[model samples]
Target: MTINRLISGALSITAALSLGFAGATVATFTAAAPAEAASTAGGQITRSEVLARAQFWVDDHVQYNLTRRSNTLHNDVEGAHKYGPDCSGLVSMAWHITANAGKGGNSTDDFESWSGKEYLGSLHDLKPGDAILKSGHMELFAGWKVPSDHGQGAWTYSLNGGPDPDGDGWQDDWAKGPTPNWKGKRGDETWSGLQAYRPIRYKNIVDDPPPQSPPAPVYQTLGDFDGDGKKDIAGIAGDGLWIHRNTSTPGNFSTSGVFISNGWRTVNKFMAGDFDNDGKDDILGMNYGDELMIWRSTSDANSFSFQAYKSLGTTWGNMNKVMPLADYDGDGKLDFAGIADDGLWIHRNTSTPGNFSTSGVFVSNGWRTVTRFINTDFDGDGKADIIGFNGGDELMMWRSTSTATTFSFEPYKSLGPTWSYMNKLLPLADYDGDGKKDISGIADDGLWIHRNTSTPGNFSTNGVFISNGWRTVSKFIGADFDGDGKDDIIGFNGGDELMIWRSTSDANTFSFAPYKSLGTSWGNFGYKILTSAPTD
Candidate 1:
């Protein structure tokens, strides 16, 4: 789960509350009528009412006070009161306890054991109007949105400040919506260690439903959709391409929004690049029938009005084996290359968007024998090189010998044989801030990154970066997602979610430290490919 750093303050409070003495007395509350029993009597509270009550304080800027201490101008129960209730007090008021003058003077621990509540156990089981309890602090779980590649979707909450709404000074009002990082003195706490609970019956509250799961994606891709320097995610479902824009925050993407819904339904194996040399990324799509097409961007990265499709001539009979390579000719244009049963073929872009020379086999002898290959600038040269893995798991490299048309490859250099377990090999930029590019892959064991030693084409296997929890990942893409010059890893699980592991290490080593779940069901998208626009 990606912890929303913005809500860390609230989490800190929960942590503090959790440390409170266990001997504190638990509070007791009157058991109200059940929803079925009170529906006709108008005693059941609608979810909207509870939300509205919470929103009121936020809207009016109610002051915060821990002791329910009243000032002359602002009284505890009066609307004009300068200071509102503390964390527990706000929750108590929202529940309309009616006892303690509706202030709900229960301690944080008291709320955990309150007579009329039920333990939810897991945060996934939380619903609207539930209370999140730690020893020193408590917050209302208003609701949740579908999970995303960034983590569990937004978990809405209603909380009061120990001081101000921003958690800065004293006397803050209601904070409605997703919990923001409490900016107060103790902002380092997190909800990863807290407990959640819900009231069986409270005043007019009848139903508290759990959050709905996010829709499954049909296809996914990574690119700088908005040209914000941070890589964003674009997913396809049904006929629509949903763009989850990067928020410029590490591991976070904006809520999914529809980018295109008409012509993308049947698209498969999509790739992006500056095909026109227009400096904006254009899309190339291949249909199930192996019909190749290009969707040229009209203006910028954010605008994709692919009004007309340019046919790239359908000679892709071996479409399933095709791989989109970077500028293979160093001509400032992207090219299409693939391995065929016959040989490795290259369709060199003729310095024109959507135009390619006739498909020709580049490496005829050994191409058909290789199991996997990826393109990257391995020798600090501007030209892209091909790294391949053979069926026997022997890794080799084909350094580019031609920087122009009529491409050629140097003799293969053996790079060891340790990738037998890897299912996918992805090219990542300098991860350790080292000048050399590194290689990452996904296997049954999860994600493994092999740091490149300063020696050209040489990698260090002694101390490799490995993440075991990523066993469920089926596919992965790499990009400098945070605009930090360091490449980050994004992957799709077999299920509906996408996750990101930001790079934190400055040396050749790597540390995922925390993995952010983008959201669920992204695997529904058939296959995903990632490409970025050319930067001039």
Candidate 2:
């Protein structure tokens, strides 16, 4: 069939077929459009408008704190709250400032003290002046400015800067005391950090905005959606999969997409794996109908198009996710696995896209099904193994050596303690950048990181990350979210948004900032995170 026919067929099958391409909606860098009349009052706020509103707020509320330590701001934009501007406070202030712009400063109580619900879908479609998510804090998306070196890049309104006569320009660090040209260089006037300037609605603003649309967040809600060198914020809006065209200017983004299939409606959870056997990455989404959906991106990033999806008809009720793909079968092709209420389904792909001729299904063997699915070369035979957690408190294993077929269901490796239910599992590469892959998981009691032993599939709990202080580690994903090379963790809190914990000098040790609210309320389950490779 022709490509157009294929796409139309896919769309008709189910909305499960996304615009194609991994997270295609997030197109980076578009030439600034001419400021137009609000075509649709309170219509779908365009990106530029979002950025402008955010910038307005940051220009007003941004303040500096000379007494605060620079490290606080360096580590987290919101870290300076005790001394000065903080991430959450910055967002709160942005709304207050924008609504009360001409009326002098507004009192804190003029708006709610930020229960974390203010910035849900609005943020997912961020523009300049919006907030950039920091590990534990937030940074305001200053307008798109000409970078000192790169000509044009995303500049932030931050605390701790010298005055810019240009009104809303960047400020370099002060080698000496505050400089003379500083616009508002007073203890109370000068802002150490310029927070994001978004046009959020204050309590009684005349043009009070209506409830925001449901966020079409492509980035994993529990993972670093935007690859901003930091896992600071969970996705606010749009899908996480974005394409960056490295032209003279930053690049442009698109909401339209290609190559999607049906069966998405039934699929609720997904995992990224290279299924086309082309060495590039592919994805598997498990839907509500217990079906598995496969999506493929172009090999050449520069000229790639929207995603191409294929439905491998496997039904698992109450399906939650398709785990990160691994080459369980030693065949050169990438192996795929999924989880559903019924059990697990593994697909061994052919060298071609959407072809799953080599596949297998493992029903939940009497034991209550598990929620987590991960791949590891458990048996040192060069081939990888599959690991899963069962509701019956079992750590099940499926090991294989050759890339010929799906892994055989091996015996369960009982990691004692019915109490030690595996909530989430992540693969942490050796901190020193060694080739070994370590395993980390969050349980009810706390977090655990296992050092991979020589034997495949076996890990030693030599190190651990914290799980004790948290109320419920809502959603957690293991990824190099901050681009630090070391694997970091992003988790949803008992509250609305998320928190990121960075690893310290020691592999197992971590340092945390405050939680960032993604606008989703607490107890809302089924959120996840998916990290993507940066565009070339």
Candidate 3:
């Protein structure tokens, strides 16, 4: 059939298919008009506007032909109404550039170097109006959708034309098809070769205003500090205890006032947990003398006052790298795990809050070279496992052979390399709810999540989760701050601005909502930020 008939047939089928879908709307194709310049003169066009322009063609009977190159004919522009535009032509027209000037009728490779556009490294950097180009092919990224019940990553939506597989001239469809989840080669198609680009505007458009700052500095450890049932933030700076209370929003914290301030300073490292098992989170820190101190929360989840203070001892002086808080012994009390000059040790909670056994040494020789570690149940065996980097970038897991005071570790299982540069690692709760704990790491590129493909010691290397500009993140922590069952990414930008990215994927993947800035100067409060869920 002719290209025009094919596109019309496709639209008819689409409209018919969408009838029962409540919110679905079918595009009404019209005759092609003269090519016109974009509505606004020169400033950067918003993603929405870009999509709108592209949709105009989809709604028009614009036949797509790979070999037939033509510019948009909606306005009184040169080369208007000449030939049916192809995939690249559609993008060029939407971007308001000549087919030869990099916006439309040029080769896919030419668009990559088009003067008016900037190359984006990953698909994660795509905005609605961006273009996704690969060898011999190109498409307009039309944003993404989080399926109502799909336990997977967000599905990418796009607009494009092609060498119609069925010998049909060209079929126009709004939801063209699903793109590959990753950036690399996909089957015969080199999806990894896909490049995204944003058009550089030359018009006088009012730029988007700067992001508003949160009321308070969103400094570290966003846990429940005041005994309230919401996740909060806590940071220490120059003897000042800064707390930002949560204001009911998922990533938002109260900016109205500092939740609490105390005469605590020079805290080199700190963590938060219900050390006392009193059902409320508390703070633990180490000072200049390597002395361990505990600040018991005396107030509700909204505020904090010192209920008790205790110096665990000077033994922590030589120890560093305090692991994440966990109940290692299956006891109801929280314990402190860390690496010391001698080896790995755990300050076993002597069934008392803020108190530990005088002798807290566990596996000695095997831990000296361990760089990063998290105590979690990797196999769902109910016993805590030690997963970490063994100084050489090797990912190794030490399954708990025993959880008693004298814990034993099984022979380390190797999970491969590329783990050395990770600055932060955490055990992500069963993201897919598959009863297996997933792992998340923040490296120079961005946040990466390795879905547990197999129990105990297997992970998928397809972690294209968060990439692009995430290299500048200075600090980050993972927690289901919104009580969504899936862990979220909360971190500080290089400027110490707090940002929270909510999880949208339901499987062993990581796709987050755009980060909402909580505020800045959070890093200035201290290098450590603690995050935890609300306590009863």
Error of 1 at 48 (Å): 67
Which residue segments of model 3 deviate by more than 4 Å?
1-221, 249-259, 353-359, 421-437, 442-446, 454-465, 531-536
Model 3, residue 325: distance off in Å is 2.5
The digit string of per-residue lDDT tens for model 1 on 1-536 reads 01122123222222112323244432111112122211221234545445444444443345455654444112222242232356666566555454344333555666666664566546666556666666677766554333221122324444545435554445544444442333322112134333333323343466644445321110112555444455556656667666665665554544444456456767776776656654445667777666777776554444545537777767675734665456666666666777767577777776454343434546555577775656665765555677767777888778766656587877887877767767766655556655556777777667777776634444343336577876677667766566565677777766677777777867745876476777776765546444532100
Q: Each candidate's root-mean-square deviation in Å?
A: 19.0, 23.4, 20.3
Q: After superposition, how far is residue 523 of candidate 1 from its true place, in Å?
A: 4.0
Please list the residue runs of candidate 2 whose C-alpha ends up more than 4 Å from where it truly belongs after superposition: 1-267, 299-305, 313-324, 338-345, 353-358, 361-371, 378-381, 390-398, 402-406, 418-446, 457-459, 463-468, 495-498, 505-536
lDDT of 3 by residue, 1-536 (tens): 22233334432222111224356443222222212333432345544344444544554545555555333323212224232366666666555454464333455666666666666555555554566666666666543332231222222223355346677555443323232212321111123333223322212222233455321111123556655555666666566767766665554434434736656656656777766766567777777667877778766644466666677778677765677666555555556777776478877777464443434766656577886565666765555667777778788888766666576777888888877666666445544545556676777676677777665433343455666578776566655566555556777787778787777876645577888887676767546465432110
lDDT of 1: 0.54
Model 2's C-alpha root-mean-square deviation from the true structure amounts to 23.4
lDDT of each: 0.54, 0.40, 0.54
Candidate 1 has a TM-score of 0.53
Cα lDDT of model 2 overall? 0.40
